[model samples]
Target: MLDFSFGAVAMGHLVACVFFLKFWSRTRDELFAVFAAAFALFALEQVLIAWAGLPKEEQTWFYLLRLLAFLLIIAAVLRKNRRWS
Candidate 1:
């Protein structure tokens, strides 16, 4: 059901976070560090969504976490590209 899907999504986020952290460690890259943080936030957001059991209408706040994660990714990319120029 929905629970299963949420759990799977959370696990996927966690796995992504771990990989990003590993890449950050190996390369000492700020982009990887930002990515790891974003994924970690996403994983936490999924856990909160699954556990809170909030109604769809009230889930807007939860989605902000996702928005923030994406914004972080965008900001990092912009910063990187600007630095290269």
Candidate 2:
């Protein structure tokens, strides 16, 4: 059973993801694309957590999803900076 809080958070992430996607479409910025991907991953992670009825994210493999999202953001930043330099 998905909790209200989790559902709300997931929805928020999805909305942000869409906004980022729109920005990416307008500017064609890789950073915006990466951000959108991260947000979507976050939403997926939350839904998976709720559906699986997981107790703690840290204790489960689901944590990897969040880690991957953060890593993607970091990689995007690094790549962008490298391109600028």
Which tens-of-lDDT digit does each residue in 1-85 have in candidate 1? 8978988999999999999999999999999999999999898898889899989898889989999999999999999999999
List candidate 2 stretches off by more than 4 Å: 57-59
Q: Against the true structure, what is each candidate's TM-score? A: 0.94, 0.91
Query: Candidate 2, residue 58: CA error in Å?
Result: 8.2
lDDT of 2 by residue, 1-85 (tens): 3477889999999999999999999999999999999999999988888788756744379879999999999999999999999
> What's the number of clashes in each of the models?
0, 0
The CA lDDT at 2 in model 2 is: 47
TM-score of 2: 0.91
Error of 2 at 41 (Å): 0.4
